[model samples]
Target: MSTLQVRVARKVSEADGISSFELVAADGAQLPAFEAGAHIDVHLRDGLLRQYSLCNPPQERHRYLIAVLRDPSSRGGSTAMHDEIEAGHLITISAPKNHFPLEPAARSLLFAGGIGVTPILAMAEALAGAGADFEMHYSARTPERAAFLQRIAAAPYAACVHVHYDSGDAAQKLDCAAVLGAPRADTHIYVCGPGGYIDHVLGAAKALGWPAAQVHREYFSAAPVDEAGDTAFDVKLASSGQVFTIPPGRTVVEVLAEHGIDIPVSCEQGVCGTCLTRVTGGVPDHRDVYLTDEERAANDQFTPCCSRSKSAVLSLDL
Candidate 1:
């Protein structure tokens, strides 16, 4: 885990209920270099660790740019990033990390839903630089709500970029089949958006017989956490040989942290893999979106935040 440091955040632009924040280390240290489609966990003033994608080109190493939409039902992160963070105010953040990487492919298709455009915007910049054949599909509720419209409009494949507005009868729903139809040999598809959008695109791609390797996705929503019950269970920490009872209403992470154990965590909702720990013995109710079937089958990794133990006694590598 990278150390979180206070960085000065500068307001760059604002429009359509979204704001762009530029963060640079207060001491003038060079910010960690990151690829397009990479993101960092920003610790807001309200103590929310929210992930924001890097929208600026990597060549601009002076600072990292993040565009955040003030979600109406935000759990606190986006609203904080957009409304509370101001220019020159210091904010804590993690170094950039990328799970939504641009894989090697002859061509690629990028789809963005509303605020999900952050990461895909970076990918577009990277693809444009590499002279790779690509297209961008941006779907927003309306043109006014769309951020980075000017930049994406001027892209080399600008003509290929589709904008769908859901204002009225002309609502542009993402044509998953049509988008998938554009797949060429050795072509890759990247999708990011709300949970429904991601699920729709992924399901449509699979239904089209696209190989799993050819489809990539990133989730922005976190799974809802459940309360613990009165029935407590024992969790043996393999590293410390200590045991703690996980109260029915508490999560594995909560109990471990209470016992002075810190398993790296970013999004406590299980969307991020930062809180993942090895499960030495237990039937884990894997609720995280980060792991694949193979990883879960190995029973070696578990997200203590959202995942629960089916076994009466669970052992963790910690």
Candidate 2:
């Protein structure tokens, strides 16, 4: 993907441990238009690239707003943005891309967990502008932990917004059963958050008989990968006829990258399908959540960023 240089225009503390960065074109030109639920890959110092959802309204083309959370266990992306990056600093970024875009439906329901509210906030704004029937439910560990609460409360769809907190009163907490207990025809639900929260909402919807196709979700992180079960394997490149030993503790992408084979990757967590490569032979462990059940069963492709080989050897159509 091509990269664009942009300048950090401003920074604002949205909540505890959460800050929103406003980026604008360094040359003061219009940026590519993007819809709700879009995200950009922010290229940080030291070859670190991170994806952040655009929280600003889609109608605004001059600036892109992204909120970042300072993760204690971060591998440097979030922490660097919080500590090193400052206003007026120029950074390279990929154009906006969306995997959790809002779908057209008669009625829509948005569920956000903590920092997941970023994209949903933009969706709420668009829905309100279109005079569509929609409502948003945001949940956080505490009221202070929720980012963009003030902006959401001031939106035109403020009346349709509901806030829930784990520390708040039980009576006002989120009632998954009440909201998703029954499925509505022509209605689609969009959810973006941590794996646990997404799973909880999706699980409740399924148990309530909601069609799987009607439920949509985006996971910020993949499920924990257990290295204990991992075993060393071999991956042979089809063109070069070269084989790379993928040790138990290493991933296919990491091993191949060290050998100067640069495979495009966005989310190393295996949630994004950017690094999916065709599999000519052998079985893939299929640890990713991006592929569907049918796709996994087909065994024609796999995400090398996180997946492993089930067999001792695997062949890639590189």
Q: For residues 175-202, write the lDDT of model 1, one tens digit per residue.
A: 7788788446689999988888888888
State the TM-score for model 2.
0.95
Model 2: per-residue Cα lDDT over 1-318, one tens digit each: 788999999988899999899999999999999999889999988788788999899999999999999988788899999999999999999999888888879999999998899888889988888999998999999988999877877877899999999897887688988987578988999998888998899888989999878888887778887789788999999898899999988899999999999888988878867898999999999988787666899998999999999999899999
Which residue pairs overlap in candidate 1's backbone? 228-248, 228-249, 228-250, 229-248, 229-249
Residue 136 displacement (Å), model 2: 0.6
lDDT of 2: 0.89
TM-score for all models, in order of appearance: 0.90, 0.95
Candidate achieving the largest lDDT:
2
Worst 10 residues of 2 by lDDT: 286-295
